[model samples]
Target: MISEKDFIAKSSTVTIDNGSFQWSAPSNIALVKYWGKRENTNSSNAISSEQIPANPSVSFTLNHCKTITKLAFAKKQDQSSFSFDLLFEGQPKEEFKPKIQKFLERIAVYCPYLKEYHFTIATENTFPHSSGIASSASGMAALAMNIMSLEKALYPEMTEDFFYQKASFLARLGSGSACRSVKGSVVVWGNNTSINGSSDLFGVEFPNTIHANFKNYQDTILLVDKGEKVVSSTVGHNLMHNHPFAEQRFEQAHQNLSKLKKVLENGDLQQFIQIVESEALTLHAMMMTSLPYFILMKPNTLEIINKIWKFRNETQTPVCFTLDAGANVHVLYPENVSETVLQFIQAELVGYCQNGNYICDQIGEGAINLSV
Candidate 1:
């Protein structure tokens, strides 16, 4: 049981030299979405419980859709505050700095070395902007990994387990889903009674044996609308505070996770598709029923989903769709049906995509240190 205080750094007289590190971290698609966060009762100590999820969520770590970040650090004379510059795709991204600055502030206590050096962070995503994939998850995870690399340089004795665990912990403070992006083909976040070693503070790889049918599952992302979402995930999460069905939705996530555990071990494609699709729809249903309701799905999103349903029913192909907090859809299926499912997507579903644009991705083994 790792507590928040355990993440805080102890006073050290270690001298740090300047170095650079590059890391690539993937974005994750949550089968069981983490829609809201647990409420913070202690206002003075809010940062400690900041990104804790309202319910446990599990996801598949993506391969092609990721963020590759290069972090260069140098010793600075002024140790008064943190210093850093951010670049996206070789250009200064001023708009992204504030978010990064806030994240640094949140984790400053955990990684105290941040204040001792100036950082130059350059990052770029594999997917295009407005692709409906959340970059924050990959971006933060990459940055956290680089920061951990720096910490490892300072303290040479850090174990690999502690290194990744602390990196996930720091990433969680940046974005809730970012923790899952740190590692694996499948990861579980938030504490659950059924899962051993699952923690609300960070993500853990699924402990049980996953059947061969689930290995290397495919996720073809259909870009329905290449435009900004009407509601941001942060705003949507906040809405759950006063939501009428908040408790029920949270409970449903827990129950679904338990059921999905069995489905994963037994290779039940039918039950897998059922639980996944239902969870996706239930996520949006919670939004629609909220106080200030808003629908993130577009008309073409529905068309694509209908096509998937029709094709799945007629062909008995194990294809299904899940959504993020946007109009785009993630078409998920097993690797065995790749050729048939992809052909179906091209013939039937591609027309609904924005300019016939979609990304073909699969399950991945999490972030990697490119510098190594």
Candidate 2:
């Protein structure tokens, strides 16, 4: 655990040379989604910040769908202000500058070097941005890892877990789900009795011994729409504040999380499918029930979902579909049935995808430090 003093600015005597660092972090799909949050400063488990969640969430980290970010730090002659040049896909993204700047300011307390040096960051995503894929999760997680890489270079004594946990904490401040992206296979965020070492501050790897079937579970993302959503995820999360069913939904998520833990451990794919699909639907349901109701899923999204159900029922294939607040559908199945599933996707689901675009991704071993 990092102490409060670690977040304080250091004396001028402490310094590190300019360096370049790169990291590729995966995007995570929450099975038991984290939709609502509340301030918990009075509680003992409360983090230093006010953005911690009210309940825990579990997720599966994807392998191929990720963001690669390179941070080139340079000692600036002018230390009076934070300086950085941001680029996305080899082009300057002026609109994204404000958000990136705000994230740097928020994390500057812990990573004091951020203010001391100018950071030139170049980021690229494997999947399209603003689609169903969690670009924020991958993007923020990659940036957090880059920050931690610089810190570790300056302080070589930092342990591996400390670096990762701190990165996860920092990522959460940028995007809540990004915390879970730091851990691979399965990770749980938010404090819960079902998971040991789990906290509201940052996510922890799923403690239970996961079955082999789940270890290599596949998630083929069927992209129904490549365009941006009408309502941003930030807006969707905010609607939960006064949502009529917020309390009950939170309670239901907790219950599903508890049950899913057992399913994960026992390889109960049938029950797992039920819970995963329900959670995906419930996530959309929450958005629809909000004050200004809106729908993100398109007609093709439903068609693919129905096709998946039909194929699964006819073949008894342990396959299911989940969504990520967008028009895309995530076709989940075990690797053993990958042949049949991939064929099904090509034959039926491909027609529904936008421009015949879809991503073939699976559970990966967390983020990669490409800097090394």
Top-lDDT candidate index? 1
Model 2 lDDT at residue 123: 99
Candidate 1, poorest ten consecutive residues by summed lDDT: 39-48
Best by TM-score: 1
lDDT of 2 by residue, 339-370 (tens): 99999999988999988988999998788999
Off by over 4 Å in 1: 40-44
TM-score of each: 0.98, 0.94
lDDT of 1 by residue, 1-372 (tens): 677777777766667668899999999999998999885443345677688799999999999999999999999999999999999999999999999999998998788889889999999999996776779999999999999998888888788898888999999999999999997789999888888889888999999999999999999999989888789999999999999999999999999999988898999999999999999999999999998999999999999989999999999999999998888899999999999999999999899988999999999999999997
Number of colliding residue pairs in each model: 0, 0
For model 2, the run of ten residues with the poorest summed lDDT: 1-10
lDDT of 2: 0.86
